[model samples]
Target: MDSTDLAADGWEPILAAALLGAERAPPGGPGPLGDLVTEADPGSALLARLALHGIHHLAGLDLAADAMEPVAVREPAGPECPPAAANRLYALLTGGYATRERLREWFDLAAAAGMRPPAWLHQALLRHTQHLPETVGAVAGAELDWLARACGEDPAAAPAASDWTEGTLAGRRAAFADLRARDPEGARMALEAVFRKEKADIREALVGTLWTGLSEADAPFLEACLDDRAGGVREAAQRLLPRLPRSLYASRMAVRATTALVIESKSRLLRSATHELVVTLPEESPALARDGVEPHAWEQRGGGVRAGLLRDILARAPLHAFAGHPPRLWIELALRSEWAEPIVQGLFSAVAREGDPAWARDIADLLAEAYEGKVSGLRRTNELLGRWVQALDLLPEPEWEARVTELIRARKIEAVLAILAKGPDSFSERFSAALIDWLAFVIRGSDDLRRDLAKPYVIGRLGERLWPGEDIAATAAALAARLPEEEGGDRLRQQVMSLAETLELRVAIRREFQP
Candidate 1:
């Protein structure tokens, strides 16, 4: 029959019977097999009987003619059959049954015939058969072997021993490995005894199967196995133990790395640069030098003058740990190192925190020198400006105002202007007024500072701030007086006019700020 014919006529009857068989099986419950039985309805039992006959016919076997007679017909007068006959009938039905439902019916029939196979029937079938063939000999052999094993009569110790071999053990092992992945703990329990007593090679094979299920909970078991006589088992456990949480080694390392040292500033300039100059070292000291002033310097020098250990200590200490410490100490150490890049980075991080600006400006000048004539100057400028903007917001208005005053005092008009330009919108108005006043001061001050103040950045910052609703014309007029008679002057004036137009500020740029 074509597939459609098989499904519609032949398969439907077979399926119905299988369903009834499932419903009759022991341990019945609401499972897929139960649902099948429910759906088949009405003629399920009849379908099951017909399906059992069909399976025997398909397998080229026949029910024992006398055995086929109704049970009532043969029960009193027929020749008695051995229990083996029931198993033979079951084997034929199962071996030839095409669907799981049909096999289930055969199982039900065997149970009813007082020939119930043992609970391990499925496992036993899977264990013995290498190949299933249509021959009656093969079928009979499988059924007899199952019967012999299930009868609590060891097939291996039978009078005529079946030829089971080492290959059977190999097959079981392979099957268990596959099952382990699906249900790790179940598989482990199945092999637990064998795992402890198996030969070295076999034990290694079993442990390898367990790697997928290894977890912290399994650590104790694995730990106990660490001293396994087999090298492979020991190695496997050792490899897995370290990856568990709360490992002993990691805790030990963390504890050993925690000591603190105090580093004093080396240079007289840096020592007097700030009143407090103590550097605290924790277990995680930065990979830089740590020397500073020793408290007992005179005693160490035997009451005579000697060189300070600050430079040597700082040179030898780790530099990373001081990254979040006080800025003054970092700056002093950085300057002592002649502004090494690592020390510079640490200083930058410290300054990035909102702090007093008198020191910040001096550090800025030092940074400016460090950055001068280098390709990275613009990057460094942006980094410092970004940090300065953040610090400005955190400090109170008065503190920011004091910082501006410090910038002016240090003649750092360009840096001051940069800071004002990048300051957040909340501080824009205050910075704009302060910037104009600073510019005026610079313009009217010593010629040298005025020349420095007239750089493009300063002028650009001033132009950017002269937005609409401000007195742009007056600011432009003041700026014009400071413009030099050079090409740079023309560029500055054009930038100022562009800024005015973009911001919609109605300002007249005089000929002076232009060139």
Candidate 2:
């Protein structure tokens, strides 16, 4: 038989003979194959037969079928990215560690320019969205789905509405939060549907998520949660319910608070006619406890729960309840009250949560005093001041900006830096630019460059807005010229130079990505 015929029949016999030995079971048949058998032994002869068969089998293997099917090609939904844009995208992927802000800008520029990223880079962009989906806003839906499918994932795996029940606690919370931002009622319904089956921890977290869209509409549910067996759930309800300006809990708290204080305006003649506003605090009501005015040790130190109950009432009550009563009146009343610290603390909370810029600005002196250490010896004052700076974020952007500049000019460097440390998310473009200009002006006008440049990093960030541009060149050169001969000066100059380089790179990147 030919090698192919022999192979098709069975190569096992030949292999077995090679392994065992032809002496054990010899092939008695004589042919061309038998004549070619080696003289060494049965094993060697079998080896020769197997090698020759393999060669014949491979040589005679079939090449193609009689008829071939046609290949199908589909056009992509979008146009390919321009050569320049594609190169930039490739650099961002391989360059490593581009900031989320920069990545977001790149995605925005590419989409706006109608450039679809190359298919090869799909994996790269998809991998980036794993950590920060916020950057996905600028990425096109078609590209995103295509990339996901290419990565062997379902196109709808990262659905617009996530399956909240399928992930870890943190992951589920994140999903719920995202859903809450998009559809508050839907998120609430999803949580409520599973509430009975959820564990205590999850119930607490789901309740907390209501803060994303807290309103009078949510009051019925939050009020129901007040009776929850879980302390965390009940506490979250207590915290969030009062934030709703028109909620029953807020209204109840406001009524209870207003009743505790009596504000009277009297006109009396000392030298001439003058106005005096008097505020009086009455005996504590046992009913206040039900409105979330429970006494805490922090407040008890001032005197007792009775002495501090007014502050708790003020805190829980909406600031709008006191709309007609001026902030100066409240300040004056707080100064006169036995529970001044708690009262002031409550005012900060009210103004902050209520987002009353007028009241917030009115309390600027109190905030500054606390920050300057004049009013911070007490733990309550220190804590309230901490909250005050945070509440500063809720102030109208322009007002907050003015306050920041005021703080910087007053040389409250630590306090100004503390506000700055809250990050760019806290500062508007107007505030950031103005603050940087203020800092630069402060540095340039100062005779002590050595001291002014002590915090080069902060200076560097503020200087980032102007570089490779003409505006910053003079300031940078001036700073460099004043660099001391010591190590500190050398460090300062290095930072200044680094700031310039960063700005230069940013400018070039902006140009490269321009539509």
Candidate 3:
């Protein structure tokens, strides 16, 4: 009998007997299927009929066409990643050794090099990019698309560029941020469309994404947010507005600073020296103070003027307002100002936000000079000195080392090493040699020196960045030679050995990258 005919006529009786355990209800029925079953024992008969029904039903079905849609053929094939690099990526993702940042670097390089990772790696990479949206912009779109298709995934299934409206709140934030970095206008438009309906927390998060591509284009929307019904939403807008130098909030801050502080100049030889900037404070601050300066609940101290308000105004004021004087004059002004701490803090904030290497170096030099021998005299300056040193570190390469070394020559070994650690992994070859020589000298004085050098922050970074070329092997051997023969020395020796390994790995990786 046809499979359909057999099922149409005999399935119910077979099902009933199977459910009844064949003892209570025999497996017989009224058709050929039932007749066939009747030839066997009750239990065996029931099983036989069920098995035949399945086979016949499957044989007559069109499963493939019914279940799956046609996939369009992908265009001209994408290039595959190099074997060595591919191996490295697979090892990095699967080996559990690579940090999140390192994985991102690999993804970025693979994408930038126009190479697609092996299909198996796509899932891992997709998951990785979800947490690191900033890294998404670095990954090549074509590589992502290729990865999705090759893995039997819909080309749109890759998580790197998932829709902003989809996913958990955190996932949506990450996706929104990724899109914002690339297409700020589009992201803004998307956000504004659904923003009013979002919950307070989600609205705050969505507004925060505006920081990615903040410009005058975003000013109007952010300005309107100042009046938002939610306090969190309004506060977020307030915090971000001043960061945009050209924003109206910043302009108002500039006006406030101009109104409150004035720099005076007096003639000195052929040049003009700043006499002092006159700071005018309101007898009592109004609620406007809360707009720029955060409102805090505390008893007021030091009855001169409102220090917090002054700092808030200064920090938000345009850096250009504090310009035109050399860093020395600026520091002098800051040190002597009645609002000295506020002024100093403002200058530091401006230098950091301005991102001028020269300004940063100058500020670092000035602070170092001001605090020179009288380290105990200016206790406050000493506290702020760490921040200035950190600012110096942000300068490119040798500048950080040069300025730091100049300032910290009189500092202790720990102090010098602290500054050194803040710098990039490898200095110029000449600088690396000097540093290695200095480290070797320090090691001679104490076994503990080796412990410090062994730190991943120190040696690991040094190994990665130090391109000592011909001197690497010699330097490694020399460092090892300095280790004392003891338990501590053995650990030191191992640390040095690890440095050598890292250098070798970096060299191999670099060679792979070479065309």
Candidate 4:
């Protein structure tokens, strides 16, 4: 370790000579390398030996190894997202109000394009989309460690087993609902674990989870709940039990329905019997309340409420208990019944809840006839008329245009808007075109309608509800362009232009997610 020895391997002696001009040390390396300083080129030999040995000196230096291996991160998978599409999602995460509001559209487009959020956007998405595990898992599988940690810290982040015992009420309900889907038996045990001790909100939400995947398996549990003290739990049970036809509660309702309502027929000479529905309000039973019938008089005044009680009861009744006929035939006959009011209401309720396509079709056909006046006896007020229009949505999408077009050209503004309101925020292209055509019709019609459509609030609501497809917007703009540029057209023109502009902006927002 002499200072001049310098630890330069066997070349230290040569290095010393180079620096201090000490006696040229004898070559100590093996064989030809030891004889490196030949008389032919001693200077180059020394430099060459120093250079080669320097690499060996560094390699031989002692160093500590790493204490642990680096944490493994999931490798991101999926096609690369388009630059523009990823940017829009970035804007949303970075506080772009316009883009954030259309998350559903962005999701649809992102899914269609088969690209997930880029790795860099993962953390931002985790913080912002705390509740959307599907989005997190879907777009950023690599970020699951972040998501798992997030769910642990915040119950509202995602459903978990712990959610059943603790965390936010919403988290508990979400956990319970998720359990209902994956393990109905486990969910029942979870619900039963806390049903007696939890407050009404918790109890209610747990029972309500039965709404999906409702089956006879849940019947006994729900039937026991009907006797619970909490109205929420009882009401949830009441609502769900009726969907299971074989439940004892349904059987009781069926008995009551058959007894209270009978189809009486009168004989005719050599002709078919004239059949009609004869509804006689049944005597009240304590079991009625237990079975979800509200305790209200059969004839309580303001028209629909008291009758709604009966409607609620019959809603749970078996379809066959009402009559031995298709929904349309029975509903038509009920329209002529002495007690048409409650009977018709109950029949509609039953059909709506059942959602049998054939029954839904029959209901839609009959209701459409009522709407068109081809069928009579079902009297409707303005409010009922609005509901009737909305009900037409049950008809398949193909049949919608003809009926909707007839309503639009007829200038049935309230009814058309009712149908529009009932529709999904993003309408089918054909429906959007119809809406645009209606907008044009309204612009050309009366001054009052035109002024109403021009209002900021009305137009804003439309922008919120309607999908802003480029074609739909362009069609509307063309309609505005075609109108004569007169004083009467000025305000209406601006309104149409405004709607078109709104649609265009939304279309662009959607396009940001597309390739």
Candidate 5:
């Protein structure tokens, strides 16, 4: 009630009686004392009424009602989330450890179930999802645009596409590719018109947009880019040209690759030939420069200029141009030449571009053989391991899993990471079950203090990749239950217990979403 309402409700009269001496005025104003029948004096009655109204006044009895009506939220068209799922959301929101990740799970489940968080959580949910860009589509179907708008966000609206030229370099690059997809010719023309006017970096980035609808159609325009003022632009064109078949740029690269290295084999009678590479650095020319043979003037870090040139040729050359050698033979030759780094980098790029599974496998196999044994060449070993991972990524799913298994047996921590990698987007049930089993063994029921602090990180990365089973939670719980018996075990026990809770909560989350 407002001050006026409080006064009008007989408080003013009671105040008057008190001020003018209640013995004279007889404290008879309508108040909490009105119904009392005892012969209590008016002063005592005043104290009684004062006690009642003081608490009421302190609790906002004098506050006026708000003038504006709150924006009424529309009732969700779909049913509200089950109380259990809502509880799960509240737990994730209020608790620590993989909160956002678990919330992502809840968002997916709720969106798929065609349900929304209870009205009370709408504000919190909006605030959280707004900050997590990855959660954009996870809750898209949750129908929370009205809530977003009430919070001053126009979630239902997208900005109109501005003219590409008017946008920042990054924005233009993003929009140009989209434009290229929609109108390839127009996008090229747009790039061409601004090619001379934009900064070298902008020109280079704009040329990158050609990668979107890259084909022979874009080759002529890209070839013209080879002679652009910016060397970056020329190199960008050089990289893109090889992606288009039968382009003169690719043909030039093929000729370079075919002639760049000669294999001379020395053999004994009735014996296998031992091959050696006859490689020499060719002098630079305008043609080589235009094709980005030396992409930069700075000397290559891992290999010299010649090695860089060879890597470029290998990256762009047609597979058949390298003496018809198998991937292994090619790798052997590169290794013999001591250009292994260049070759690996180049071949990895080419394999990805061509999506040649056979080449990827052979390259991965050769690189992975005695991979960790290169202790003397740690940097080189890491580079090669990374190459193996990339190549394996390109392999078919079953083959990828098989290789992951092999890596796990080698007891590679990197392998474990690859196996337990945040997933369900690509990981299979068989893969997850085996990996989780491996994790329990690897961690040794949280007894592995060497890997102690890392437990949460690994477990949190699960992203719901586990197979349908309550075994992991049970194991963690049992370990947590027993840890207190050991000295200096509280922290480890707590960590293990959290893992158990996360797993159990995940199981419940999955259960809540099931039909």
Candidate 6:
């Protein structure tokens, strides 16, 4: 017979025999011919074989000869099975099965035949159905129940090589962790059913996985474990319960925190203003105040009973209440908490305002250190510049120009450009000239913005003041020298040449000076 025909006829029996033989070998143990089976053991070999047979029979492949090997092994007197048999069995289970339902049925038969499916099979099922919610729902309950029972069973009662222990739990935990990303609900259900009954360490291992698919439905199960005999298990559940959605316990904790009014400090500085900073729930409050919720003011209290109590309050508060609160409040609170520079800078533009002198000055210094030469967000740089300009205007014109010159000296070219772009006409001609000087500095310092300076608005403003024709081409040549060596350089040179050609009178005089 042709190899194709032989393959069609013999593939099923060969596949089934391989699975059955492999299932009978030890898990993670060597099979016959040195093939490694993930679940290496005799029982696993039987399960693998059973599943292979189910798959072959279901697909109309004849497995009569293949079935005999496992049958003979199971019978009263059979030759010792080779380890390769187990490898063959799992190969069959994974190779040709189409639907998860078929896999589950095969798994059920494998379990009945005293073989355990590899932990990866559970993970595979969860991952395949993540984007297919209906399929996840269809198989989740059944899969979870099977996993729970398999995990719960006493390993001692199982065949010697098939027994599971702490080692087995570790493997299962790893598998469940992977499963959590795909089917958190199913993973939780499987773990929840056995969490309390598991050993203390195992319970912690299981609850740690809860963070993956954590939701309101899982809360009650987690809450019940808060009083678990194991301290670690209780603490883990305690840590996670507060994060669940609309948790009544969390709500109650928040209410208890906000409602209890204690006045421990009677000092003037501590109780400076009776601003009546109202704390109202978002859904219960009017629309205007709805957006006005601030971080709990009491969070400012330094350590001792006051600080500890405030931490408790903020911890339990509805996260959604704080979600719409201004990011500025968080920055202010973070500053009070003595947070680092990056944290302050990350939220600086969001909360720092033009009118707040102390905040504005601090942010300006921060911008100088970190933002110079970086391609910063234009809107953010402009806002800061607006504040700086306002601060400069408040100073005398001499002082204002001095400060602008200081900024130019510091090479804050972008901030300088932004300030000049927005500053009023009242700014002195000396200051405007200083700004053109800053533009020249920018052309020398940064190739990209120099090209920007060649634009009509920027060029026209510079040209109007920096008069005396000879000065123009010197500026253009200065800009041209800074251009990159690529197409951008070509573009920059073209733009500069165009500006020079248009202002020919200035160019001719400057050309004489160049020689």
TM agreement with the true structure for every prediction: 0.29, 0.63, 0.66, 0.70, 0.64, 0.30
Q: Candidate 6 at 266: error in angstroms?
A: 21
Sorting all predicted structures by lDDT, with the top scorer first, yields 4, 5, 3, 2, 6, 1
Go through the candidates in order and give each one's C-alpha lDDT: 0.45, 0.63, 0.65, 0.68, 0.66, 0.47
TM-score of candidate 6 versus the correct structure, residues matched by position = 0.30
Off by over 4 Å in 1: 1-327, 350-398, 409-428, 441-451, 463-469, 477-488, 502-515
lDDT of 6 by residue, 1-515 (tens): 34574455334455545655653432332334124333446666555544544454455444343433321111211121223323333443455533333344333333334343234445444334322223323324354344434444322221222122236666656666677767878777767666656889888877877887678888777767766778778767766766663776556544643443221223467566321222222222222112122244444543333343444444444434334333333433333333222233323322222133444444444344333433232224553445445434434445546767788788765666655543343435456446546665766655667666555544443432343344544555565566566655565466555545434433332332221
- lDDT per residue (tens digit) for residues 1-515 in model 2: 46665556345456666676657855624665556665576556666777765565455456334213333343455677666666776676666664554565566666666666777777777676654335354455566675555444666444235767766666677778889888998888788787868877888887898788766888888878877777788788888887888888888877766776657666666654333334345455545544556767765577666657767778788876777677866765565555666677777778777777678776765556555655523233545555556657657766767877787667665566556543344445455555545556655554454355556445556544432343444445555556556644666567766655555455555566555
Residue 341, candidate 3: how far off, in angstroms?
A: 4.2
Residues 363-471 of candidate 5 have per-residue lDDT tens digits of 6676666365532232445555555566677677777777777766776766455334322344566776666556556656445532543555555545345543566
- Candidate 3 wrongly placed segments (more than 4 Å): 1-79, 119-202, 258-292, 295-309, 336-341, 371-388, 394-398, 401-415, 424-438, 444-482, 485-501, 512-515
* Predicted structure 2: lDDT: 0.63
Best by TM-score: 4
Query: Any runs in candidate 6 off by more than 4 Å, and if so which?
Result: 1-169, 260-274, 278-302, 321-515
Report lDDT (Cα) of residue 400, candidate 2. Answer: 68
lDDT of 1 at 132: 30
Please list all clashing residue pairs in model 5, or write none if there are none. Answer: none
Candidate 3 — worst ten consecutive residues by lDDT sum? 295-304
Clashing pairs in 2: none
Cα lDDT of model 4 by residue, 10-37, tens digit? 5455566567432464444565545554
Q: 25, model 5: CA deviation in Å?
A: 20
For every candidate in turn, the CA RMSD to the true structure comes to: 28.9, 9.7, 8.1, 11.1, 8.1, 23.9
